[model samples]
Target: MSDRKNILFIMCDQLRYDYLSCAGHKTLQTPNIDALAARGVRFSNTYVQSPICGPSRMSFYTGRYVSSHGATGNFVPLRVGEHNIGDHLKPLGMRPVLVGKTHMIADQEGMKRLGIDPTSEIGVHHAQAGFEPYERDDGIHPDLVLKPGVKYNEYLKERGYDGHKNPWHWAANATEGAEAPRSGFFNDVANQPARVTDEESETPYMTRRAMQFLAEDDGETPWLLHLSYIKPHWPYIAPAPYHDMYGPSDVQPVHRSEVECEDPNPLAKLYQERISARTFSNDERREATIPAYMGLIKQIDDQLGILFKFMEERGQLDNTMIVFTSDHGDYFGDHWMGDKDFFHNPAVKVPLIIADPDPAFDATRGTVNDRFVEAIDIVPTFIERAGGTVPEHIIDGRSLMPLLRGEDVAWRDYVISEYDYFMQPFSPKTGRVPLECRTYMIANSEWKYIHAPGYSPMLFDLTNDPDEFVDLGRDPKFEDARKTMHYALADWSLQYRQRETVSEERAGQMVGLEDKFGVLIGYWDENDIEPPAQMPDYASGLENG
Candidate 1:
């Protein structure tokens, strides 16, 4: 009875798609990501084309658009020869097993737009793409984290921290240096049960390495795993019963009313004296503060209830294919924001639960798909469910497996969120942060759109303001729905970044001339992927116009 479905792919870094209680997110418990969204198919308008974190997981594993994988900025690097989805499902025999973190870095200009042969660049960037890294680390950096272990930094040094003031180039502050690293946030081990061996958790070391990789392997073979966590992404540290799980009178505050944020785009201003709401506030700071982000979303919902109770005690929970989402999201204090580079909808609308334990999609079990998917349709929905064939010249994402077989699939009406800062940092010399050509969005099923570069269009009609707190891009009776959504946000930013080739002859004008005329030509020196040793004369003079 092997319908061939093994693919776990759970990710939760900076998780936010309304912190799951089936996404309305009132208090945040996550009951195992709401029981894996009652057995899969959640997508209440998903997103993440790019908000951050390795260019939104590299435009979600090459469904493309980080400006067609130039990875369009953010510490730059990644360019390796395209074909990922674990090099296109390891050629149909399926085995893309990652089991944690797939931010996928690729250098050498992503290996010269992947024609392949900086050697053969496989997995994690195998020594400049020749292929070998099932795991590699090139001086791992994110201001380098993975801290806490002096009995958890001496339990954040008996707690009253003072860690990051004299120039914390971002990240530092969990009461600054130690203590609040929150080791078991004071785990009183009594009537025993909290035990996942809580050593100040990172979702019990990523669900004990995904339950020792789905209980000693055979998670139904045809794999694609991904895992990636760092905790509700922050030094918001949570250890004991999720560092207290919520109190300040059942914490839910921080939706912004004061400390400024009526922002109808006075260029959506920032740096309001370095924002706050530290471990979140508003409900008279009662301290359980959304129970330390719902104890780090129930410590990743108890490592997704230890990988769905080890896939229902290894019967392999009806054939596998989980998905639970998150790559970007976590503003916690909404408007008076704190994290996530901005383009709200609680920071790029996440939470996408997929679950599919098939009987050819058993009535999409427990069903909830409000359609509108996009994370570049998750690598052509894992290369058309591994039987493979999404190769529209390497990918632009498209297969939600025909809306996961409920069929009527039309999709892609709108869903794009992009922002840039080039891995955000540097100001002292005003060195970085340029190329501020930004974009923020939301579309009609009630409108939102934020738009940037000396901002202005802030619209929001999410039907009587679904908590986008009115700005209707500045009313005047919706001035013809703000000039019809400013030419429908310039036709949804030019038909989702339109370009679809034209060339009968305009190759960036004669391959953009090299040192011209007398030409000392310093570059255009094809270092490898050969063929054009000399095709020069189209009426010579290195052809311009």
Candidate 2:
């Protein structure tokens, strides 16, 4: 067998860092995820580049920040030419295969302008965010209105389920006997058991399909399989046993202060008044959906157990590296917020565990790294594991290999996160909130700073206010500290984006008929010579090696 390492990159959608037992949640126990952490390294503080889906995952796949890649929101496409994890690893003889959702929209305008066919191999890769899809189910079934009948829908229909009524909802999102025509709202069907069996739900289906892919894999080349799960996100319903596994008592009390609702950041106050948080804040709604959310997580943990056992039995575990993390966390009504957007710990922080099987990392096995890490670092880590050099100009992250190998290394002193709330349909109608669209956060172990355009900045001394309940942006006592953080943000903002740097150089170095610059084609023979319209073809006379 080849000595090349395989990567099982697993990502859970909307999973919070504190939800896992290893991350210090007292109630929720993720044995399978905990097992991975116990066998490897757990990064206690990891932040996503963006708080939302598309931009966050784009940063993850491209190893660049949201500003760098320019996929600033959900449904926004990563630019066609951007190098992603697949683009980087495939050249190293590793197949980057995707088994689940990427949430990447195709750059339709770019493709059309470039005359690229969406049905072609390269076109399909760009459409799926640069990875070849083994199964591309983004998990928002009803949202696939553009293309009727998605793969998951067809899968449900094939199994005698009613696809006419949107079986994805019937089988995965809705509970048994919850009104024949239930609205596709979590508040309507929350905490109920799905009509389908647990094994037939989306979580188990994804797991089984992943295992099937492994069974059929040729195993001739090293591969990076991205097993992305889109559960524990919403619709807050689980199948059969998992649905009934938890209750309202299991739901942790909402973490917030009444004072937080008063004199809040303009955006935070606006978010609290929005439908997302308001809907989740109702006492009954929280009781109904939060438990279901926990159940969904439990189902994921159980499925992970199955996948890990299969890997061990197939002897793939010893040669494979397992990475578990999420794009971002759900607020869960923390700080009077529901969905992820603000810089609160529950919204920005995510769990990251990397289990390297290489003997060099044995010393760091079962260790925890508290230094702040970002989602961008994932691509670089994968490249390093695949024995490839990361493209520094394109990738904006450092490798964790040295830490994994138990070597002391100098790391970044702070981490940054960004969010753009302008696109959200629900805006501040009262006009009390500023029209600021962008929010940037620069944080270290001691202080967290938030800056929004045209609004009062917010600052929290994390050493004292770990939950970030108090904002000191206007406090005179914190003027010096806030100023220091502002400098960090300024430094971070000044870094070069360099999006077209390589493209421009490549264009300049290539001429009409050969790999030669027009000015340099005969520079040695004649200092300044115009190149021929069409260089003489030389391939025909070149001897075969």
Q: Pick the candidate with the highest TM-score.
A: 2
Off by over 4 Å in 1: 1-10, 13-91, 96-202, 209-211, 214-223, 228-283, 294-328, 336-346, 349-374, 377-472, 475-545
Against the hidden reference, what TM-scores do the models get? 0.31, 0.90
Error of 1 at 290 (Å): 5.2
Q: Give the candidate number with the greatest lDDT.
A: 2
- Per-residue lDDT tens digits for candidate 1, residues 257-323, read 5524554445445422234434333333324344565667777787778768877877777776778
What lDDT score is found at residue 370 in candidate 1? 82
Off by over 4 Å in 2: 143-146, 163-165, 428-436, 499-545
**lDDT (Cα, 0-100) at 345 in candidate 2:** 86
